[model samples]
Target chain A: MTVARAVTCPSCGGSIEIRAAGYTVTLACRHCGSVLDVAHEDVRLITAYKRASANFAIELGSRGTLLDIEWEAIGALERRSPGAIWQEYLLFNPYAGYRWLVLADGEWQFGTLLLDRPEGSLSSVKWRGQTYTLDDSSEIETTIVLGEFYWRVARGDSVQCKTFARGSSYLSSEASGTEVTWTQLVPIDRRDVEGPFVVRQRYKPRPDLRAIREGYSTAPGMDENDLPMMFLVALGALFIIGILQNLLSGPSQCVSNRFDVVVGAADTTHKIGTIDVKRPWQFVTIKADTDKFDNRWVDLDYSLVDRRTQQSIDAYGIVEYYAGTDSDGPWTEGSHHGETLFARVPRGSYDVYVDAGSHGWPSDPRPDTLDPKNPWSAPSTVSVWLAACTGGYSWGMFWTFAVLLFGVPCLILWWRHQD
Target chain B: MSKRLILFSLWSLFLIAISGIATWYAWSPFADDERPTSSAFRGPTHK
Candidate 1:
C-alpha cells in the first residue's frame, strides 16, 4: 500500500506533492527550489538550490512502463562532477521498489539497487557470471533536486562514487562514510521508454567517455572472432574446388612440333607447324630452348593466328644462361629454356610464327686478347616448341577475392576497437 | 527473433553473397586471361 500527501513549502508556500508519503525523508520545493528535511513532524530547511537550466527531457510525475512494470517518475536530481553533469529520475512502483533512470547526453541507463553487496576488490568485481573492471572513481555532488526523496539529501551533498562495467552493463557503488550502496545499470534505448506516457523533449547526444566506453563494449552484429573463422572455412572450400578442377582437367598435346631459327642476326620470322584445336577454353603453351654459350641470352616473339577469324595473339619467350666466378664462389642466374602460356583460345585452325634474336659476350672480355673485328660476339640457335592443353585453373584470382571478403570487416572492427 | 540474432543473420548473408560472387568470377567460363605481349629479354632471366 502507498499514500500521497501535499506539503506546503515554508519559504514560498508552493504545493509539493509527496507520492511516497511515509518513506520520503526529504522534499524539495518546486517553486522556491529549497531543500527541505521532512524526516520528523517539523520540516527543516537544509539548503537553497539554484537551478542552472530547466530543459529536462522527462518531466516529474510522468508515468511510464519499464521492464514490464508500471512506474511513475516521483523524484529528480541533477548531479555534477568537474565538467560533466547528469540527471537521475527516481521511479516508484507500489509492488516494486525504487529504480533510477539516468539521462546523460540523451543516453538513458536503467539501474536497480542491489540488496546484497557484491564481494570483490575495487579493481574488479563479479556479478551473475560476468566480470566487470573498474572504470573510474570520482566525488559527485548533488546540484539540484525536485519532488521528493527517501533520504535526507541536501544541496552540496557529495558522495564517493566508483563504477565498474562489462559490455553494456555497469555496476556503480556510492559510499557515504562507511555505508556503501551498489546499483547495477544497463543501457536502455531512449525510444523504448518514450511515447505518449513520456514528456516530449528534444535530445541531442554529445560525446562523452561513458557513452564511448559503453559503445565500444557492446558492438553490434557478429562476434569479432567469428568472421575470420568463417573466412578460413570458405577459403578452404575454395582451395578444394581449385584442386579438384586441376585434377579433373585433361591436358592433351595438340601440336608437338620443333623448329630452329638463326640468332645474332637480323630479326627473322619462321613458320612453325599448326594444330587444329577442337575445344574452347584450352591453353596454348609456347616453349623456347636455345643453344647458347655462357653469358648469352635469346629472345623470341611468337604469334598464334586463327585461320577462321584471322585473330592473331602475340606472346614472347626468353632463354638465357649466365655464369660467373666471384670471390665467394661460382654462380649462375638465368636458365637455358623458358615457356609462355595463353589461355581460353577458341576452337580453330591456327598458324604459329616465331621471330628469334640472340646476344652474347665472352665471360671475361679483354680487348687485347680477343679479335677486334668480332668483339667477342657469338651467335646462337633457338628451338621453338608449341603445345595445347585443357583444364587449367587460376588460383591467384580466387585468393584475391577471398582476401577482400575477409579483410574489410576485420579492418573496420580493428579500427573501432582502437577507438 | 532477438536483435543480436537478426544482426548476425544479416552479416552472414552479406558474407555469403560476397563469397558467391567471388567464386563465380574465379571459376566462370566467360573469364578471359590477359593477352600475352612481346617483351625484350633481360639478362639473367629464369623461367
Candidate 2:
C-alpha cells in the first residue's frame, strides 16, 4: 500500500486521512463529520454535520483482500431510498483502481464502476453480451458521508437510480443533473467480506437499521404490511352496506292460515291461500307452527305454485315437540315452529298448499290399527299454523362472500406480521 | 394512490358490485328452496 498524507480537520482540528490523495476531491472529517475540499492545495471545509462518525460496518482505512487483490476502504456513503437504505464502502488499490462494496439487507455486493455505458435503455440493458431486465428504480439520497471521494459528495445529494438485473448479476445507473454513471454489481458472499474486512458484528445492520438509529420518519406508502388497513376499510364499508341492505329489504306482504291434522289419521293436503308477490325479484319465507303435542311430530310440505307458469317452488318444515323424563330429568327436544326460505322468487300470485301429517314417537302404526280405547294412543288432533311472506334475505351468504372477498389481504397481513 | 391501493380498490368495488346485485335480488346460494321429487324429502334447515 502507498503511503497517504493526513490533514487536520478545519472544523474540529481532528486528524483526517487522505487515503486516495491525488484522485480524491472531497474528504469528510473523521471526528467532526465535516466535508472538506482536498482537490486543491488548501484543505477547505465544504459542509458541516453533527454526529456523522456513526459506527460503520467497515471502518475507513481498513485493508481487506478481495478477488485476490488488497484494497483499503477509503470512503463510505449512506444512501437512502423511500423504502430502503444501504451503505456503500469505497475500496481503493493503487494498481487495481477503485471498487465498491455495498451492504444492503445485511448482504454484500461487489460493485465495479463501468468505464463505458451499458448498451440499451433503463428497462433492459446489455452489458458484456448479457441482457439485464429492469428490477427497481427509485430516487436515492446520500444521507451520510465519511472519508474521501473522487466527486464533491455532500449530504442530501440525490440521484435517480435504476437497477437492471439478470439472475444474480445486477447493473445500476445513477443519473444526476449533468451526467449519468453506471455500475455493474454482483452478489458477493457476506462471509467473504466479513472475513477479509473484519466488519464489526454490531454494525452489520439490515438496511433500515441506520434510519431507525438516526430517527428517520417516512410517509405512509403502499407497503404490503399496510394491507390490513385496506382490508379493514373494505370490511367497514361492507358492514355499512350490509346494514343498509337489510334496512331496505322491506316490510313484507304475507298470507297466513291454520289447519287441524288428525293424529294417526290419513295424511291430507290442503290449500293454504294465494299470496301476491308484488316485486320483480324477492325471497319468500314459509313458516309452520303447531300447538304443543308431546311424543308426536308433524311434518309439513309446502308448494308455492306460480299462477302464470304453474311452476311449483317446494319446501319442507317439521314442527315437533318431544318431551320425556329420561336420565337427564325433564328434557324437551325440537321446536314447535320451523321455517324455510326461497330466494329470487318471481312476481306473481302463487297458490300455497301444504301436505301435513302427524307421526307418533318410536313407532308410527297404521291409521286403522290405532284404537280410541287405547289410553297411550297419540293425541287425536294437532293444530298447525302456516304463513308465507315475500321480501326476505340471507345474511349468512352475504358475510360468507365478504370473508372470501377479504381473505387474500388478511392472509398477506398475517404473513407480513409473522416473526 | 399506489398501484396496490388501486388494485385493492378495484377488488373491493368488484365485491361491492356483486354484493349489491345479490342483495337487491335477494339471491343466495344458501337458499333452502327444494324441488319436489318422488323421493322422500328432508325437512327445514336452520339459517
Error of 1 at A304 (Å): 1.1
Clashing pairs in 2: none
TM-score of 2: 0.45
State the lDDT at A299 in candidate 1: 66
Per-model tally of clashing residue pairs: 0, 0
lDDT of 2 by residue, A1-419 (tens): 54588987654546778888788889887765678998877787776523454546887788999999999999888889999998999999999999999999888999999998889974798988999999999999987777787877766678999999999989999999989999999999887898888687786655577665343223233243456567776787578667756754554888899989987566799998888777677788888888887877787777889999999988777777777776667877778888877887777889988888887775554556656579577657899988888767776777776786688676665554443
* DockQ of each model vs. true complex: 0.12, 0.24
Q: Candidate 1 regions off by >4 Å?
A: A1-224, A240-253, A261-263, A267-272, A279-281, A289-293, A325-331, A361-386, A395-419, B1-41, B44-47
TM-score of chain B of 2: 0.63
- Please give the CA lDDT of all the candidate structures: 0.66, 0.78
**Worst ten in a row by lDDT for model 1 chain A:** A361-370
Please tell me the TM-score of chain A for candidate 2: 0.40
